[model samples]
Target: MLTELWNQGVRNLVEGRIVLGPGLNVFVGGNGSGKTSLLESCHVLGLGRSFRTHRLARVACSGRTEFAVAGEVQDPHHGRSRVAVEWAGQRRSRLNGQWIDGHWEIVRRLPLVAVHAGSFELLTGPPEERRRLLDWGAFYVDSGFAGEWQTWRRAHEQRNAALREQDGKLAARFETVAAAAGTRLTGMRERFTQRLAGFLCDASTAGLREGLPAQIEVSFRPGWPEAESLLEAYARSRPSDLERGFGQSGPQKADLDIRVAGRPIREASRGEQKRVLNALVVSQGLVQVASGPQGLTPLLLLDDAVAEMDETGLGGIMEAVVSLGWQCLATTVDRGWAQRTAGARPDARMFHVKQGLVTSLD
Candidate 1:
């Protein structure tokens, strides 16, 4: 869990630091008052990227050329370790004031799960979003999953290039590598999905006030025929691959099917969808805490979470977050929500933001 957070020139947030509580930390202010920016800073420190924007430079405040976010994590065995991200023309990360190779070092120590306004995209958006979420879990639980994922991606790219050149021999070679790695990737994802389903149901039962349907089922689509091995599937799809100048099927096209009751989550009501997304976030955190490496607790970032829900639903989500006993940084425009959440946990902390200034409210 994060013990202290500091940021400079990030979005509209004033250069400042906040001592974070291990349980719940809520930032409250009106829209455009920098509430979300504070949460984004925590996201940056944890993930080395912005949940609101793709370009890191955009996180800089108006007319600023760069931004930096740093934080201290409470390591049970090591005491406290510092992680920082600084971006000007290029990105750099530091661990304990020493330069690190990449953000993965920080990610490994401070994995985070975010549920925001765009979280609904998990259901309404394309397959990549869902796939990304799935891989995040697999990356933490299955040690070999990341290396194999990169290997498969490289082989898949090579196979596509070979097919584009109409080189059957080269394509076949890369296909063998891709198939081997892809098959393993599929297995890991399948197992992670199975675990996610159980956690999702648990989170819904505990987090959603309105409650989910009688049955919640989560399934994985491996992006290929279930009957054929990946190698065989590659051979079967070779014709279409050559015609299109790209591989026709692979794990890159994988998706998740989240069914509430008997129907897809897309068919659910707005309030139901928001609650479901919150539950999914909680479930992902639970999966990580249960299976991740020792002493590494994933942080939860909620930006105006459960926006479509009433007070009852929001309180339910808050209750679930507090119960997790992990670090949570949440934002809200509603003061009531902040107060209620702060009251739920004796260790909870609250901060108010206005015009880029942050003031802690004990």
Candidate 2:
């Protein structure tokens, strides 16, 4: 659980230290009051990137060249530890006062799952978004998956560079390495997706939707023809990849196919799609908590999660959050609505944010 958070020089938030609760923590405020910034800070601390932007420099306040976010987290295995991330022209992260190499180290200490307006893309957006969801689960469930994924990404980049240079010999060598790493990456993702399917099915059956269709199905597309191996697919696509100036057939192109009653998710109504997306996000956290190694439960961040939902939908989502027994930080513009949705949980707490200031309301 996150016990405290401190931010400086981040967007509208110049300075603040928030005491967080163990369960549902809601931040209520009007738009542009830095509620989302707060959540982004947590994301930066855990993932080393802002969910709000691709460039970390964009998060720095105007006239400032640096930003920092730190948190006090208690892991069942690690006990209480201080995790800090600082960004100047570059990023530096430390865990328990010792310098760390990358974001995955922070992730292992503080596993996080986030859902926001953009998260709808998981359903209606490109395959990359769904692939990220799959990879996040795989990263947490299997410790070695991250290294394998990194290897695949590096090889994929080298292969692309070789293709762009029109170096057939170099491309072939990198392609072999890429295919080997991608095959392992694909297997890990496939296994994680299969495990998550059961949790998603259970969530749907347990009233993820009321009048809306609950028949949701999920499948993995390993980014290549199923009848052929990665090496075979790479060979088949070599000519096209050379012409296109990039490698095309590998785990880099993987996707998660979500369907509702035989119809693609894109064809579903916005409300139906949101429910399905919510189920996917929440079930992901459920899988992390239930299947992760001992003493590891993901922290969930929901940015304006209840904006479009009715009372029933809100209740169902909140129920799932409560049932998973994990910590969740949610943002809202309406305090009453936030309270009403999270009030039933004994550990739920509320805060009010105005123009970048946060005050406890619990």
Candidate 3:
């Protein structure tokens, strides 16, 4: 659980400190009061990225050259530790008051899952989003996944460079390395997806919305022909690869195809998409807890959860979070809604945000 969060020079927030509860914490404020920025800070600190945007520079407050977020986290196995991330000309992270080489170190200490208004993109957006979701789960469950993924990424980059240079020998050499690494990466992803499918199935059976079918199917496309080996696919596509100046077939192109009642979920209504995404994210947290060795419960950051979800949908998501024993931080604009959602829970905490100021109302 995250016990403390401090942010400086982040968006509209010049500086703020929040002490969070172990269960649900709600942030209520009007539009542009920096409610979402607070959630973004936590996402950056935990995942080393933002759910709203990919540009780190954009997160820095106006007229500020740098931004920083620090958290005091208590893990079941690792105990309490101080983790902080700073971004100026470059990004840097520290653990237990000592500087670390990479952001993954901070991420490993504090695992997080986020569902924002745009979370429906996981179902309707591009394949890269789904790939990221899959990889995040694989990274948490499989210790060796990071190294393997990095190796495959490096090899893929090298092969692309070789292709651009028209270096046949070099490209072939790197292709061999890429094929081997991609094969292993794909295998791990397949196994992880299988485990996640079970969780998704259970969530679907439980029903995310009323009158919805329970037949949600998740299929994995390995980015190559199923009948041919990666090596063979690479050889088969080498000419097109050279023309395209990049590797077009491998784990890089993998996608998670989701369908309901034999139709792509993307074609569903907006409300239905939101419900599916909520289930997908919550189920992801459940899968991680069940599969992780440290018994780590992921912290869920939900931005504008009240606005993005209907009452029944929001209630179901909250119920799942509580039942799974995961910590959640949700932002809303309505104080009544916040109170209604959180007031009954003994462990729940609420905060009011106005023009970047945060006041606790527990």
Candidate 4:
């Protein structure tokens, strides 16, 4: 859990710090008051990337060339650890004051599950978003998944190049490696999906929906025909891949087929969609913690996601998240709802943000 967060030159927030409570931390503010920026700062510190925009420059304060987000987290494995991310001409991250070349350590220590305005994209958006959901869970649970993903991506790139160059032998050599790594990636994805399905079907994790749908089935599509081996699929698609100038079938094309009552999620009403999304997000975190990675509890970031929800809806969601035993930081423009939420939980923490300034309301 994130115990302390401090950032400088991040978006509209010019140098702010907050000591976060372990349970539910609510930030109340009007739109554009930098409540979302605070959430984005936590995201950057945890994942080394922003959930808002792809470019780090966009997150920098106006006229500033750099931004930094640092925090102290109560890691299950490492006790208290310091993690920081800074972007000037390039991105740099530090763990406990020692600079690291990549963000892997930070991610391991502080995993994040974010639900923002664009979260609906998980249902309507392209397959990459869904694949990302699977990969995120797989990374935390399966220690070898990251290496296999990297190996497959590298070999796949090489194979695509060979196909473009019209070298059959070279293409075949890289195909062997790509297929091996891709198969392992698919296996890990399959295992993670099975575990997730069990969680989604459980009442404890998915009870927020209150029996919304009869059956919520989530299946994995391994980016190739289920019956065919990766090598066979690659051989069969070689002609098409060569003509298209890139490999067509692999984990890169994977997706999670989510359905409700044997119907696609897109057909569900807006309210139902939100409930399902919430269930999925909550289940994802539960599955991660249950996967047995010691000291690695995911931080939940809600960027006004619960806004406009009715009192019961908001209350149920809050109750569900608080039961997860994970720390959460949620923002909303509804001061009344924030107050009510904080009032109900003696351990809850509250903060107010205005024009990027944050004040603890505890």
Best by TM-score: 3
lDDT of 3 by residue, 1-362 (tens): 79999999999974867889999999999999999999999999998887888988889988888899999999877889999989998888899999988777666778899988667789988998999988988887788888889999999999999999987678888888889989988988887788777877784326564445655678889999999999999888888888888888999999999877778998887777777787778777777787775668889998988775677887788887777778899999988889987887888999999999989986
Tens digits of lDDT, candidate 4, 86-134: 9997889999999997787788888888888878889878997898899
lDDT of 2 by residue, 123-162 (tens): 9888878888888888866778988998988989998998
In order of appearance, the predictions have TM-scores of 0.93, 0.96, 0.97, 0.96
Better of 1 and 3 by TM-score: 3
Where model 2 places Cα greater than 4 Å from the true spot, the runs are 203-205
Candidate 3's C-alpha runs over 4 A off are 203-210
Error of 3 at 301 (Å): 1.1
RMSD of 3: 1.4
- lDDT of residue 283 for candidate 2: 77
Q: List the residue pairs that clash in candidate 3.
A: none
lDDT agreement with native, every candidate: 0.83, 0.85, 0.85, 0.85
Candidate 1 lDDT over 133-227, as tens digits, reads: 88888877788997899899999999999999988888998988999999998888988898888886663446562565555678999999898
Query: Relative to the unseen true structure, what is the C-alpha lDDT of residue 291 in candidate 4, on a scale of 0 to 100?
Result: 82
Span of 10 residues, lowest total lDDT, candidate 1: 203-212
Q: Please state every model's RMSD to the true fold in angstroms.
A: 2.0, 1.6, 1.4, 1.6
